[model samples]
Target: MFQSTKQTAQTANLTAGGHALPADWLGRIVLIWSGYAVSMFAGNAASYAGIWYATETTGSPLSLALLYVLAFLPMGLLSPFGGVVADKLNRKVIIVVCDALMALTSLALAAWTFIAGPSFAAVALYCAAFGFVSGFRTPAYNATMPLLVPECHLVRINSMDTLLGSISMIAGPALGILLYTSFGLQYVLILGGFGAAAAGVTMLLAVIPRDHGAHEQAGAWASLKEGASTLASQRGLLVLTIGVSLGMLAYGPIDSLMPLMVYDHFGGDGFAASLVAAVMGAGLLVGSVILMAVNPRRKLARIIVVSAFVVGTGALIAGLIPKGGYWAFVVCIGVLAIACAWFNAPLMTLLQKNIPDEKLGRVMGLFTAMNGLAIPAGTALGGLIAEVTGTPLFFQIDGVFILLLAVSIAISKSVRKLDAASSDHPTVEQTL
Candidate 1:
């Protein structure tokens, strides 16, 4: 059932890592999905445990800010190099190595924390290492997806990715808190380490295709330049990149302000804020599930445009709700989260289909760096705006900007033509 007869022996013979394509392609995908899901859960859990420990131990805003900086700084610094490595080297090896490094780093930190008790320095060190590794890991893993799954199912696979990620985010924090409270920070950290190790081992067993005509022999700077050139030359991709970055910037502050919005605007406590956050997560989970099941493979552009509008509208509605309208806020946030799943899944699929596998790592890495920069900048600006005009005003203004961005994308000839163009020039499927 997995390998249809129409996919003849020649296609089946085109192997990943010199091995024949598995008969049960579906089963292989399931295994890969399970491994990554565990890794995501562990990573999120460890992050929460570290942050909670830092907050409880230091109780210093500066220390928390430092923690945040450590979490992101390495990724910003190493992303370009990561992209180069991903394109130049065996992607599967990079994945295994990065995951293993993260596992080892987490384990060492767990031991240190256990021996000396929790310290901000130890946690910071672990975060920095993990972040550095992630810079390399993310693109390699993403680039591997097309190799494992057929293009026809890419949207469904991407939706499932978001679904599992939302589930991990929702459960990871609670698990971290539970483990930390019941056992200790050390145990939580150890759990994260085990999760990473398991993910690495699992992927190690899964075959990935070698790079075809990759710019491996070229100088790193030249390769980087080529990746940049690819993005610059592709009008549709360039438009999508700019639009997504701006959207991230516009919405960045909302991520950090949800709890504040619940508490200050609705006169609610931490528990109530948690409930709102949970509802948003639940919404994402639901949206992902539907996308995965329905697996819409057409009208990708319209979906993206409509979803972006929904996201902006949801944010605007959240801000417009009157004081004490807690349920209204929850509903708005839920819609926003659902729209996010729709916004992200097809967008990722579109990029994957358009970009060549040889350059995907570099493109994704550059994109990640751009997103990283935009989000923090937007977050800082949002904070300043909120301080001056209040959170609701900031949200309202941000919403308008996002809505405008979506309208522009909807009208853009390039964006409207992306999916159809992508389909006409299909990527060569890598079988394993």
Candidate 2:
């Protein structure tokens, strides 16, 4: 499963080349990270503009629902294949190609919208293409992590990811709104295209190893089956996957409805939505910083379970707040956001450490696919429940359900035994 504390320390002392890491290891990663940050920020900006445009133009729930489906469905459907591609192809090439393709498609959409005027179809098409590429891009990107850094630095690096994402969430939407209002959706789309393209070009400078095992003769179905088997081979990983997948059901509604909750329950305005998001982003940044500094190496299973419980507690408190308690709701959201880093970063590090590099892409792809599917299903279920009961009731029930799930994971002998199962095992090493 995972390396013991001692083994991790031993591995951390060696670089991907089995020699000591250069003094500039952190600097090298930062160089790569800067490119990603720019690209993601621009992508988020485009997405926000599209959503806002659709809301203003169509005002149809059906159209909005379609946009949501398009956003997630491609990833859900194509992730397995993407995972196979990641495992068998040069990951750097895959990343660059995905970024380039996405940029081109976005540019084409911008042209179409500029010529024909904004249409739901154009936005939906862009979202679909972007999502499709992301299915592949995300797996490769994640799989590349172990290649770039020592095992001990995984937590800190992943936390950096969380921190960047938080900054994007806080800044992207506001920037998108401003650009859209001042200029237009076309400009926003062009901005996104350039951003992605720049990232692709910049990524070319990074030196990454090719996948040697990818040449093995295997059909797509065979590759998928192999990936599935790899995941099933590890009981702790299997359980962890299932637990987190189910947990997405609890998260879907919260993600899709958070703005609505603020607007309806707390009598929030447009600024209030941004305010809540900023608070949550700040909380995530703080949590990420703490994890980066602490870099917890022991009792990961316990941390995951406990963080999940904290998340549930935050949700429960949010739901229980009296009407007009805006500040209280914000605090709960902050707590939920902070707990999110704890719940996710550790599990991600564990998977990266334990899984073989060749199989990492497939495993990450499967995880993304499962979680992607769960989100839309959960969103629909949560929406229906909210309609029947209330938003507050939905949050409360989701919290309780998550708490139960966490307790189940905590009490499981398999999960509890994970810590002791940690051993010094030889792992295939690669680098970027």
How much lDDT does each candidate structure score? 0.76, 0.78
Relative to the unseen true structure, what is the Cα RMSD of model 2? 4.3
lDDT string, candidate 2, 1-432, tens digits: 234555656667764324455566676677778888898788877887776666567643344445666777678778888888888888889999999999999899999988998777888898888878878988888887777678767778888888887787778777777888888888889989988997798778776656434665687788888989998988887898889878886887776666667766777754576677767777788788888888876677887888789888988888999887999899889989887877667778878877777778888888878877777677777877877777888889999999999998888888777765653343333121
The sequence of per-residue lDDT tens digits that candidate 1 reaches over residues 300-403 is 77787888899999888888988978888888898899888887778777777678778888887777766666665676677667777877877898889889
Each prediction's TM-score against the native? 0.85, 0.89
Which 10-residue window of candidate 2 scores lowest in summed lDDT? 423-432
lDDT of 1 at 154: 80
How many angstroms is residue 375 displaced in model 1 relative to the true structure, after the best TM-score fit? 2.6
Candidate with the greatest lDDT versus the true structure: 2
